[model samples]
Target: MRAAVFDRFGPPEVLHVVHVPDPRPGPGEVRVRVLAAGVQPFDVAVRAGEMPWAKIQFPQTLGQEYAGLIDAVGEGVDDFVPGDPVLGSTMLNGAAELLCVAAENVVRKPAALDFPTAAALVAASQTASGSLLELGVGEGDVLLMHAAAGSVGTVATQLARRAGATVIGTASLRNHDRLRRQGAIPVTYGQDLIQDVRDLGLQPTAALDAAGGEAIAQSVELGIPLDRIGTIVDDKAAADHGTRVVRAGRDPKRLAAVIDLAARGEVVIPVQPFPLDEIVEAHRTVESRHSDGKVVLLIAS
Candidate 1:
């Protein structure tokens, strides 16, 4: 099987497509013929060695979320069968034609969604859901979300709105209109964020920090109880300040909830899928940090 392999990571240019041995599922695992692999900030971080835990056995295949068809199951796995479509999240080994993961990690894909979109929904959406859920966000809560146009931000806004929370989202001016369309009150990133929220007459009852700038950290520091704040990035800093980390690949129950939202059409993943040969370009596109939505890799059958 051919996989994109990198020895020492630096830039996207370091990635190369190489033919090596095909991986098989061990006990309690399943081998998936990957149809689409979702690339997130984490994927880019792994490629650049920014994420400390993304390192595993190298030469590494760096991807965390995928949607594919089951090809084979390990001895103890009975939850899935060959030909079934599944979507899942993992910490590593996802950027390839096939993946071997615990059967528990793979959830049956919604019949209504396509593979690439399914792949895009899990990691980002789940992280969003977990943070909101942990903060106990519900009806009548006014929520503040930093980086409101990001993949997780988009989903978080939608989900919070669906739950009847009034959402104020912070993004660049160019993204404010779309954020409003998604049911959020938009504030430009560099604007007086707190004063802007106050201008809307919405006192924020909770906040999710997806952007991780000093501004966000200072906002939490000024008043928002450290316990009420959660960040999907900057885990170390968040911890240092008593803010929570919305750790991805750490909660399976949250993942199931996210999958349910996608099935219900409460979450949307807008993206384009590139094949393995173009994997280098895919990584580059994500690294550029200008993608409005996800950029995924479609591992050819």
Candidate 2:
């Protein structure tokens, strides 16, 4: 199997695709023939050695979310058979021609969505869904989302609106129209972010910060309750403001629910794709933090 790996932690140039021995499924696991893989900011962190807790070895694979078909099932894995289409999260081996994941962690991919689209939703869906649930965002509540043009923010904004909440999304002026289409009142993010929201006559009852660097503090300045303000990034700022650090850990059930919504045309995630051979370019795009949508690797047919 061919996988993208970095021999040493450094820049995106460190990434390269190499062929390795195929991995077979173990008990309670399923081997997938990867069709697409999502490149996330977290993957960039892992590749750059910025995430201390992530165990890295020389020539380590770098990817977290993938969509593919089950090519083999280990003994005791009866739910998924050969040729079952699935998508799910993995630790660091998603950017490969084949990967083995725990059967329980895999979610059935809906036929309504394509492989790249399914892969795009894996991390964003879980993160956005979990963040909203933790912040208790619901009907009548005004939810403030930072980085409204980002992958996680895009999903969070749409989900909050679906729950009957009024959403105020922070983004650059260029994304304002896009946010409006997502059912959010878009406001520019900057020193006057609070005033911007106030000018719109919206009071934020809860906040979700997908963008770091002062997002948590700005939410606090809006007078939103500390507990109601949640952040998936910037743990230090979250601590400083005494706000909730919504871990929004990976959950297959949560991912599946969002996937179902996407299949029904209720949730949409734009995807920017690069071929697997151009792994370095894909990494650079995610590192730039300016991608208009989720960045994904087209691993196979």
Candidate achieving the largest lDDT: 2
**What is candidate 1's lDDT per residue for 76-177, written digit by digit as tens?**
988899999998887667778888989886788878888888888878777887778888889998888888888889889998999999988988888888
Candidate 1, pairs of clashing residues: none
lDDT of 2 by residue, 1-301 (tens): 8999999988999999899999999999999999999999999999888999999888899889999999999999989998999999999999999999999999999999999999999999999999999999999999999998899999999999999999999998888999999999999989989888888877899999999988998898889999999988889998887999998899999999999999999999889999999999998898888777799999964
Poorest 10 consecutive residues of model 1 by lDDT?
A: 213-222
Clashing pairs in 2: none
Cα-based TM-score, every candidate = 0.92, 0.98
Could you tell me which 10 consecutive residues in candidate 2 have the lowest summed lDDT?
Answer: 284-293
Clashes of 2: 0
User: Which stretches of model 1 miss by more than 4 angstroms?
Assistant: 236-241
